[model samples]
Target: MANTAVRVRLTRGASEGDVAALKAWLERERKLEALRSSGELEIQERAGTQDGQGQARPMGAGLDIMLVLIGAAAPKLFDEVYEQVKSGVRAWRENRRDVENGEPPEVEVAPDGDGR
Candidate 1:
């Protein structure tokens, strides 16, 4: 069985931005298409996390597509691939100036009240 992208989020140590970057890179690199054709793109199986919120982005790697399970992959691994995605994203934005991506807010980050 070939290695396919599994729907897993990066672990606590993983960087969300990094993972995103990798996906963008693969898309532009044309790796995503190849993975899809090879049946390696759509076979992600994310692992568990401790933050209790590791299921937002799909995190995985291979071929044409990139997966980030919001929050379930290892941080180190996620960062590594994310850099690739970032590169791709840069390439795409540079080529298509008019294109704009507005990602909706998924998480609500609010700090607890601490009156000093």
Candidate 2:
């Protein structure tokens, strides 16, 4: 079957617990089991990059969490998964002081090209 990847970029870095919560949520999505079984469903965290000066930086820190999906059904299933993941991220961000004014995290869903 054909496969595609959906990249979910969050507005802030996600903690390990947050990633686990998202993983659990995705695991419970039984309707997407086929994709999971085929090894198409995946979630990952992208850490912030360091500056050229070797100092710690938060550039693109917002584009932290990423979700990868594979399989021919991925296209049709993207919206549902994106919504669920975004909801989860928002909830996760609410309690973090790093989140601006405690506002819900913004999420951007896009195609994961190059499969990195």
Q: Top model by lDDT, which number?
A: 2
Estimate the TM-score for candidate 1: 0.29
Error of 1 at 51 (Å): 15
The local lDDT score (0 to 100) that residue 54 gets in candidate 1 is 33
In order, candidate lDDTs are 0.35, 0.53
| Candidate of highest TM-score | 2
How high is each candidate's TM-score? 0.29, 0.48
- State the lDDT of candidate 1 residue by residue for 33-85, as single tens digits: 45445543332222333233534434422112224312233333334344444
Can you write out model 2's per-residue Cα lDDT over 48-77, one digit (the tens) per residue?
343333466564443344566766666777
Q: Assess candidate 2 and give its lDDT.
A: 0.53
